[model samples]
Target: MSPEMTRKIFLYGAGGHAKVILELLEVNERRCAGIYDEYGAATQLLGYPVSGNLNDDYKAADSAMIIAVGNNAVRRKLARKLSANWATVIHPSANISSRCTIGNGTVVMAGVSVNSEVRIGDHVIINTNCSVDHDCVLANYVHISPNVALAGNVQVGEGTHVGIGATIIQGIKIGKWATIGAGSVIIRDVPDYAVVVGNPGRILRMNEPEDVAGK
Candidate 1:
């Protein structure tokens, strides 16, 4: 597909986040093929019908999909099970630099700023108003929550979840499957599967196997 043209989108989750993505599609002037909820949570979302079974749903050959759920591990897991064209959704209000490289199936929400040489991987979420400064690297399935800020050259490993209002200083390396708590200030490196919280960001506990993978 051409860079200027957008394929019809099929959303995987019909929850509150899907509501925002729906509006984002509107702003982009792209059509939604359908909405899907694996748990059958709702019959419809904002007038869009929700498919009860993803396997049985009618899909367009040219359509693309965006996993609209918020959980990092859940998105990663579901992404592995489904095979289709991936859609990268970016809000029109976002300020992404020309030098930045974003991967497929990533969703960059409104008011976000991604600076020069930043590399964001597949199925990542740079949520509302987040700022990823120069040379930051976000691995696949990472979630940088609303209002989070990452200074220059910070490296977030795969499936890491940086909670709302968190701040990570420059040159920090956050490991895979790590969770940085809300409002925390991360001054140092975070290890894999560790859950950190508080002002200076101390490790609260190591997440159980199920915590990171949702097993």
Candidate 2:
């Protein structure tokens, strides 16, 4: 097997997102040692054994891991609990420009298109079928949900969650810990911790500081 294919990696989720990530790993020919989930009841996932609880010591220091949880807050919490080397999983079907920089622990899902000079931060999730245009900057722990479209030069701050089918206009800046509701079309700058919705993307509410404290 090729060197890249021979690398063993562990996954820290067993839900739908994990299943998709597992498929990505398989298609890339990387070996998945097992899956870990704190709440898992089943003994297996997608034919791979569900090894044990998420907190259990696996003792595979050489192996890397990816946080496959879809919830941005939960994923961020889980990321801090582990000190293992993180793995970046990119689906082969995704078209990513060579000029783009993806940080460690990021996952680029199937059918996603990331254009040139985009800077994606650590532990970020660029979910299925999303299109990120050139020069977009996504901060750490950000989650761009499925079918989201980010126009060129858009800046998404840390821990922000861009909901599914949301579209941001070019040069818009979404603030930290904000939430863009599903199907919203952003045409203006969003303030920190704001929850925005609707076609033109109006602010519905501001997420309190206490709500985003730990995450």
Each model's total of backbone clashes = 0, 0
Candidate 2 lDDT over 1-215, as tens digits, reads 65445657889888888888899898888889878877778678889888555643434655778888877777778778788778888999999999999998899999999999999999999999999999999998999999999999999998899999999999999999999999999999999999999989999999986666363
Pick the TM-score winner. 1
lDDT of 2: 0.88
By TM-score, how accurate is candidate 2?
A: 0.92
Local distance difference test, per candidate? 0.91, 0.88
lDDT of model 1 at residue 192?
A: 92
For model 2, what is the error of residue 42's alpha carbon versus the real structure, in angstroms, after optimal superposition? 3.1
lDDT of 1 by residue, 20-75 (tens): 89998988888888988979679999998898778633245668899999888899
Q: Worst ten-residue run, lDDT, model 1?
A: 53-62
Pull out the clashing pairs in model 1.
none
lDDT of candidate 1 at residue 172, scale 0 to 100: 98
Least accurate stretch of 10 residues (summed lDDT) in model 2? Answer: 53-62
